[model samples]
Each structure stands twice: as structure tokens, then as C-alpha cells.
Target chain A: MMTIERKPPLGKKVQLMATCLCDAFYDDAAVATVQVLEHLGLTVEFPQAQTCCGQPAFNAGDWAASRRVARHMVRTFKGELPVIVPSSSCAAMVFHGSLLAFEHEPDLPAVEQLARRTWELADFIVHGLGVTTWPGRFDAAIAFHRSCHTRGSNSAEAAATLMRSIPGVNLVEFGEAEQCCGFGGTFSVSFPHISEAMGRLKLQHLRAAQPQVLVGVDTSCLMHLSGLAEKEGQPVKHLHVVQVLRDALKNGGLL
Target chain B: MKFQPIDQFATTLAPEKRQSVYGGTKATHEKRTKLLAAQFAEPDHLRRLAGEIKQHAIENLDTLLPLAEERLKAGGAQVHWAVDAEAARRQVLAILQRRGATRLVKAKTMVSEEIELAPFLESHGIECLETDLGEFIIQIDHDHPSHIVRPIIHKNRREIAVSFEKNGLGAYNDEPEVITRRAREFMRKKYLAADVGMTGANFVVAESGRLVVVTNEGNSRFSLAATKCHIALVGIEKIVPRDRDLALFLNLLARSATAQQLTVYTEFIQGPKAAGQPDGPEEMHVIFVDNGRTEVLASECREILRCIRCGACMNVCPVYRQVSGHAYRSVYPGPVGAVLSPLLAGEHFLDKADLPKASSLCGACNEVCPVNIPISDLLLRLRDKGKREGAPSPGLPPMGPWALLASQPLVWKAALFCGRMLDHVPGALIPVPAFHAWTGCRTLPKWRGGEFRKWLRVRKK
Candidate 1:
């Protein structure tokens, strides 16, 4: 993928927090996140010491475990560069969820610092850099799936605005776009039937839009929806919004 | 109460069946909420005032309750104080016994449903009738109310028509208007003939000693006016400081509940018939029920008492939209219920311990709440409290091992390497419990070039 020209006055480097989902399952999203950042004129660094965001443990009522992992994350990404996460759920874990994780830890100041610098990919692009329109064009119609975390953060509007700015992409809207896709980390396994049911409904709504692709800010939702859609032999393709935006920027020949 | 796992409760109704029954109500609720947002010029400011009023009233309940009681007594209405649900029930029975009342007409109130007053009264040989159309239908059909505000929300109009016809009304059509008319005609007779009218107040204004009741149907008016005696069963937390504060609450209640500027009827009952009003209850009784609410006030989740039972939280909740109310297996359901039920019931009530985990911690409930209760944060706190009390979630790997693996890079790398080595083999070939559970619905990604850390490490070198 080719990188676009940089507009000055924005921070130069961002440490990419490739979430456990990106690390283990959706590596393409991790690659696309880096490409997307570089294209936006930001130097991207991968901190190899990072693993999980401690969200799974935090949400599962294991504060000790969450604190242990969150402390490590704070230590690994302890720099001035903004920590950019492709997954809103993981980004939320860093920015918001980690507050609960490190409440009683001695490194609370460092954790607070990490949270202040942490930003979801869409939020960092649209708000941190004030960039809405990017060099991109995808002829395919795209429907967006919003994670519960995005709806809470500023990322909900950011993702939508960024997607709408793609010159040739058709931003298809659907009902229940903001409904949870039921991939609540451990919730998917703890309550598989309910999780799968919610995913099915989300997929059904996405299909109603009849878009060529379903894109979302979080890959966990896509993973859950895609898994359910695949099992039912439903013909639906999933892509991260970052991937869609990055692909179009590369295709625009703006290197 | 017996404890049941959430998945087991969820499986009670198949996902398809639950969706078919619940989907329409969820959509209608979403539309109503949108309309409410559009109509209100400053919803946030209105909510702030309403929340502050409730918080202040609750903080000074000792002063307010006595003032309310004194004013009610001065106005010729009897005010009875009950410390708990049993005492509250006994108070109602005593009133019925003294009046020698055999027939009862009741309107919609979650508090009444919370106390199970109808069944208790029925067992004591009083013929209790539900005057609200939804409640009436559920009563005849021998079913509990599913959704709090909309009691029979799980049933379609066709099912309701069948229930109405089979119970007593002959050969009713499925049209909602016709069913509603038939219910009104049947309930009007009960209202005119019943010895006692039982109602729930939306707000208890201390200065005026009034029980404010709001309803779309005129049944509450009929229940309070058509009978000889009226009894308003109210929770202690429903107090507002003065009659003037009602203007703010009324707007929030209707807008949050049904997206109306105000419900069709908002009646202020200030002591009996006011000394010769031709058409009002001759005797008025206000039973202030504590029912574990003081404990709720003293707990860390004191903000939960700020809930006015508007039910805006349930309407926006994705989990409630999916599973419906009965899945919680409690009088209260959805986000508010998840917080309130376990808190009210105390630690011995293990049945409701799992209720806190029912949500996805999605803040939709919080966003839509008129009183601004941080329901998602409360749920998280409850989950932590539950863990401290030694009730870990059933059927999941303990977090200790994963936390340790996550903190140490080498061990995490080793685990990733082993996962990659196993990934070349089909995912189904793995027999691990967590992996098997995950793969049941979604495919595990095959490890290609190890995890991102290893790939990034090699690139760095």
C-alpha cells in the first residue's frame, strides 16, 4: 500500500496497540491500521512488549488479573506518542476501562498517562488530527456496524464521518447499526446462544441494506457477525473501516 | 429463591421465538425514544433537575415522609407507614377487612407488582381485577407481567384477542381497538361495583399531600374515583419536595416512557373527596411502604433509588430487547432491575446474583435514562462485588492464569507459538474447553506467521 502526503502540526508518531484480536485472529486489520496511519502522515511503531489490553479480565470481574495486564500495557507503551488502537473495545480498555483496572495500583499515574494518550483509530484521525476527508475511493457500497464501545466514545460519529468522506464509496445506512453485536469479550462464550442470536439479528439488518460489504470500527463485532453469517451460509463479507479507507487511499495513487 | 444461570434462563424461549415476540416492541420503543429526543428542546437540563430533586428528596426522607404524613392526616386521608413488604401487605389487608371489601379494582404500578399484592389479595378471597388493559389481559390469562410499563408486551394482539375471548369476552377480533373497548367495558363494570380501588402513585408531593398518578388509559381515574374507598400503595422513594417539582417530573416521566409531552391523564389526589366533591373516593389511604428501600439508600448503589421507574433503560437495553423481561425471573427486569433486584434482595438472594452479568455493559441504558443513573457502571460495580463475595461466573476459565500469561511476554509468546503450531491442524481438531466453546459459533483463525509480537520482532531485527 502507498502512503499519502502529511499535513504538518499533528503529532508525527503513534504507537499501534494491535489488540489481542488483531494479534491472534485479524492480522489484516493490524496491517491496515499501520498503513492507514502512515498514509495520514503519522509514523507508526509496533510495541512488541504489548499483548492484551486486560479488557477480558476486567470485564470478567477479575480486577487483579486486569491490573496485572494493564500495568504491563502502561509500562510497554510509556512514551509521548499517542497510542492508536484499531479496536474501539481495546482502545476503550486503555482509555476508560483501565481506570477501574489500576484504581489501587502504585503505577496509577502512569496508567492515567497511558489512558490520556490512548486513542481509537477513527477518533485519532478525525479529532486528534482534525482530518475527515482522506485520499480514498472504493466503488463498493459499505454498511457500518457500530460496537457498543464506539457509541459511548466520540468514535461513533468519527467512524461515520470518515467513511462518508471516501469519494466513491456508498455509505449505506441500516437500522440497529448501533446495537451491540454481542461479542462482549468473554460474553460471547459465557452466553453463546444469546451472543449468536444478537449477531444473527445484526447480520440480518446488515443484509437488509444489501451492501457489497459490512465494515465496522471494531473487528470483534465483525468476527462475531462473520462467524454467525458463515455458519448459516449467509453471503456477507466483513472488513474493518480502516482497511476500506487504507485500500482506497492506496488505490488513489497518493504516495 | 433458587439461582439459575443466565444462559439457562435465555434458553427458556428459543432465540427465534423471543425475537419474533420482542422485536416489534423494541422497534416501537426506539421510534418513541427518537421522537422524545426530537421534541424536547433541553432534555438534558430537564433530566438534571429531575435527578437533583429525587436525590435531594431521598437524602432527606426522614423529614419529607413525616411532613407528607402530617399533611395527609390534616387533609382527612389516612396515612399508614409500613417498614417492609409483609407489613405493607398486612396494612392493605387490614383496610380491606375494616371496610369489609370483597372486590378490588387496581391500576398499573410496578410497586404493587413488586409486592405481589394481587395474588395475595386473591388468595384471601377478594376478587382482584386489573383495570389497565394490558394488566387485565395478563390477569385473565394467568400470566405475570413481562415488561414493567407494558405488562403484556410479549404477546401479540392476536394472542391477546384469544386470551380475552377464552377468559370471558366472547369471540373478540384481533383489532387492538376492539379488544381495548371490550376490556374497558368489562373493567368499567368492575370499577363501578368494586368495594375498594387500589392504585400506585407516580409521585408523592409532600407539601400538598397528593398522590400523583399518570396513565394513558383513564382507568386510574376510574379506580380512584368510581369506588367508595381508594388506597394508594407507594414506595418511599417516590417523594418529591413540593407540588411545584411535579411539573419537571411529569414532563420527564411521559417523555421517557411513551414520548408524549404528558400522559393522557395526570391526576392529583389531595385527600378524600375534598369535603363534598360529588364524584371521588369517600375514604383515601396512602400506605408508604419501605420494603428494603432504606437499605438500598445506604448502599453504594444509592444512585439506583434515583430511578423513577420510567423504564427508559429497558427500552434501550440490547440484552433486554433480546431476552425480554421474564428471563430475569424477577418482578423487575432489564437494566434497572439488574441493579435493583439483587440489591433489594440482599446477599442471601442468590437467584438474582446472576442478574448483574446479564448486560453487555453497553451504556445505552445510561444514555436514554431520564434520571441519569449510571446503570452500566453500577452493573460493573455489582459484578466486582459479586466476585468479592465468591460467586465467579459459571463455566468459564478463571482469569488468574490468563492475567499471568498476559503480564509475562515470554509465556504469552510461548502460548502464541503453541497456538500457531496447533493452528495448522483444523480448529475442530483441538479439544480444549474454551477453544471448543469459541469454535462452536466462530472459526478460530489459523496461526500463519506467529502472533503480531513475533512478526513485529522479526521485522524490528
Candidate 2:
């Protein structure tokens, strides 16, 4: 279980909603999320009953399947402090899809409440706990690929702002930072040719940046890009924005 | 020789058959973008260059227009300024009358289509013939271009063969070369006998008053070279400051369009004919049309004026690939078209509202745009404009209430629970037309009768 730290030291405890992608593919992001919150002098709690965010189904045009998943998520984190999600994709599902998913359900009011409390990991850190500075540093050039769901769909200025705040980091700006990476969930699978083409184009841009690390809020994009990078033997490393920050905080400003 | 309804042409050829051919073209387009993206390894560099060029051009457009007109006039090309489409058509008709041009041969030009020039000319007794093979097919079929680069994208060879048979060319073969031969045979006569030649300028270099026409088939060369009198119609926004700017644009244009090192023919005509030139137009005129261009250029939508008409954005657009261009209901269809059509055509057209929503906001168009137009960003802005104008809703599902509910947690929870319960209902209850459009293609599931919180509570115990 995760414990949430109360903002202003008097607010209600917030719940840490470990995103399904982080929980399954990168448990380290979830663990680091907890560690970062705890380092900020707040209690962090994890609701183990959390499941997939229903994005896969929702994007596939399967509304009914998505609603079932959304209902299960709302029920699991109902009373736990405001739900703090580790993944932007999961956060988007809660913030963007929940109400629509349960518009006609019997417990629509309850579902709406759960959706409102959900905050993306960056939002929780920047807005919820108010942690402006961290005790970590990295001496490397970084290019941030702002995911579409985070930048366009959700207000994702926090992570980039946070990265800029870190010491010894040179953040390079690429053209059209808010564009999609073309890894549209099953889009990569359904339209593999176009998907690979788009991915290669993105990879070309990434290679041009020649960054030691490529940081972003969503791991799904990283996972897809990393696979291609590994195949091409590119030296660029993919890291979740939160993990980079958590590492800095854990190392007491040394990275 | 006249502009025809898009549906009439689309329906003549089976939509399913066209879908398969266009699907292949889309694949080629994607491959081309990837290859070009590789060549332009530093995407940011091109972005910076494109942005800088556009900013400079837009800022000095008034200065550039007159300078271009003067140079064109000195080169023996008469220049005419048009305030709107009607004015543009009138100017074109007047030029035809003064030149005594009864038969006209035309190269591919979107400006002519936008101003309905061919129909007006035909109505006034001039026989207009489209010289480019793709333009010829569309002209004969009386169809609007589906793709800017490939106007006949929605027509398969089999269907084209049928059109040819009706033109008295008797069924020869279903091969592309055979069809090209048939078009060539028909257009050759028109080109040879044409009283005036009309072509669209891809880029108008303000420094020298030169009009550049890029084509794969050399048809533009023939149309202009074979005529006694030549008239080039260009949008005011097509002007660039210098000759050097053409290098970057030409390099990116063909690579983005069809992945070629260069198009087959890049004709730069500074004036109608040089004093010593053996074969060229004796008389030349360039009609600069400012139909809604000044409005778009002066407003926040000015970024769209930078388009080079490479059709790179359309080629890679997924929605365009799925629905094809005819569904867009505009001469320009696809990502660029979505933003451009509504802005240029006016929001009064009911279908104009659908233009913005026709996209999934996928940003592919922005990626491949040689001029670096922020297509997706502009698309969203257009959508916001539509909503503000109370443009009739595209009948999309009532996402407004849902979007509001999703932004708030409490309402979201209640909505989710109710949605879960309704999932169990037998009959379809999708309230929004947009939502119904989605559900109509897929299935809905039944709720498990318990909220996610309830399940969590049980597990905690």
C-alpha cells in the first residue's frame, strides 16, 4: 500500500495509483515514485487493487470493455487520497475518459469523484506536494520528447520544468515537441508499415539531438523507441522523467 | 472542361476499389517520408529554415508582390491583380478574349479549381483541356482532385479504362502506360492547337519575377512551350523573396511528395519568351489571384499560406488514407485541407465544420510538411473556431458533457458507475452521434455489477 502526503500538512492523504504500464513493464518507476514522494516528506500509499487504465480498450473503440475497466479503477481508489498516477497514459484515462465511460452507469457520481482526484505523477509532485527543488543532478545533455497525451491531452509542463530545474543538465529543444511519436497503442501493430515509418522519422530526430538520454513522461513511447534504438545500436538511453528526478533526489544532488 | 461535383466522379468509380489503390499509394507515401526524414537527419534545422523563410515572406508580402509584378511586366508578361475568385475569373476571361484564345491547354493548378476558372472559361466558349495525365483524367471524368499530388488517386486502371472507352478510344488495355498513351494522344492535339496555355506556378520568385512549375510528366513544359500565348495564374501567397529559396523548397518538395531526388521537370519561366528564343509564347500574362488569401494571410491563420502543395501531409494522413479525399468535400483534402478548406471556403458551408473533426489530431501532417506548417495545432484551432461560431455540430457524440465530467473527479466517478451498469443493458444507449459512430462499429460490454472501489474494499477486508 502507498501512503499519500497531505499538501499544506493539513489536507487529506492522497493515494498513489501505480500505472499498469509502470507496474508491469517498469516496476522501478512505481518504486521510485513512492521513494520520491517519501523523500519530499510525505506519506505514500499504494492501492494494490489498481488494474489497467483501460486505454488499450478505449483507443480500440471498445467503449463497453473500457467502462468495465474504468469502473473497477474508480472502485479500487475511491476513498484513498486523491489518486496520483505514475503514467501519463493512465492519468489521461482517468482525467479524460472516466466520465464518458460511466455516463449512464448506476454509480456515475462515484466514478466522477474518482476521476477528479486522479493526478498524473508530475501533477501530483508539482501541484499536490509542491516540491519545487530536488537534491539530485545529472551532467549530461538531454532531449525531452513530450508525449502527446502528456503535453497536448494533459497539462504536462511540470516534468519538463522539473528537468530544467535539475543542475548540470542541458535540455535541448527539438521541433514540434508536442507531436505524437506514432506509437498509437495498437496503431503500431495494426498499421505496422506506417507506424515503423513514423517511428523511424522520430528516431532520426532523436539521433540528431545526440542526447545521452531521452526522457519522457510515458514509458510506452520509450519502450517502442528503445526497441528500435537497440536494434540500430544507438547509444541513447530512455528513462522515465520521474525516475531521473527520483534518482537525483536519492543521490542527494549527485548523478 | 468544367468543374464537376466530387461525388459524381467518386461514385462513377467504386469506392472500395479506389480504397485498395489509395492504400498502396499511402504505403509508398510513408516510405518516402521515412526516407526523406533520414536525409534531413536534423529535423530541427529544416524547421528553423522553413519557419524563418515563411516569416520573412509573410512580413514583406506587400513589398514582394509589386516587385514581382514589375519584373514580370518587364519580361513581357502582363500582370493582373484579383481581389476575389469572381474577379480572378473575370480577369482570366478578359485575357482569353483579348488574346482571341478559343482553345486553351492547362497544366495542373489548384488555384484554377479554387476559383472555378475552367467552368467559367468553358461557359464563355473557350474549350479548356487539362494536359497533365492526372489532371486530364479528372477533367474528362469531371472530378475534383482527390490528392494534390495524385489527382486521380481514387481511380483504378480498370475504372479509367471504362472512362477511356466512352471517350471513343475503344478498350485497348488496362495498363497504366496504355492509359497514359490514350491521354497523350488526346491531349497532344489540344496542345498543338491551343490558342493559349495556362499553368499554375509552384513557386513565384520575387527577385526575378520567375514562375516555377514542377511536374513529373513534362506536360507543363509542353503546355507552355507549345502555345502562342501563355497565362500563368498564381495565388498571391506563393511568392518567395529570392531565387536561392527555391533550392531548399525544391529539395524538400519532391522528397516529401514521392521520395525522388528531383521531379522530372523543373521549368523556370522568367518571362513568356526570351528575345532570341526560337519557340515560346509570343504573349505572356500572369494573373495574381488574392481570393481569401489576404484574409487568411492577415489573420491568425496566416501560417497556412506557406503551403507548397507537395501533398506530403495528405499522403501520410491516416484519416485521408481511410476515407479518401472526396469525403473532405474540398478541392484541398487531407490534413492541410482540413484547416485550409474551412478557412478559405467560409464556415457557412455545412460541410466546412466537418473538416476540422475529420482528423484524429495525429500530428503526422506536421511531421512531413516541407514548409513545417503546424497542421495539428491549426486543426485544433479550427475546431475551436467552429465551436465558437456555433457551426452546426458535426453530429459527433456529445463529448462536451463527457469532457466536462472527465475533468472533474466526483462527476466522473458517478458517470463511470452508471456507465458500468448501462454496459449490462441489452439495447444500445450511446446518446451521442459521435459515440454511436464508434459503437456502431464495435461491441459494448456488461458491467460486473460492482464499482472498482467496492472490489478494493472487499479485497482489503
- Winner by DockQ: 1
User: Model 2 - which docking category?
Assistant: incorrect
User: Candidate 2, residues B395-437: lDDT per residue as tens digits?
Assistant: 2333334434443456644554575545555445544443343
Q: Model 1, stretches more than 4 Å misplaced?
A: A1-11, A101-110, B1-4, B14-20, B42-45, B172-175, B425-429, B448-451
Cα RMSD, model 1: 4.2
Q: lDDT per model, in order?
A: 0.80, 0.71
Model 1 lDDT vs. the true structure?
Answer: 0.80
Report fnat, model 2: 0.01
lDDT score of residue B51 within candidate 2 = 61
Q: What is the C-alpha RMSD of each candidate to the true structure, in Å?
A: 4.2, 11.5
What is every candidate's C-alpha DockQ against the true complex, given to 2 decimals? 0.47, 0.05
Each model's interface RMSD (Å)?
2.1, 11.5
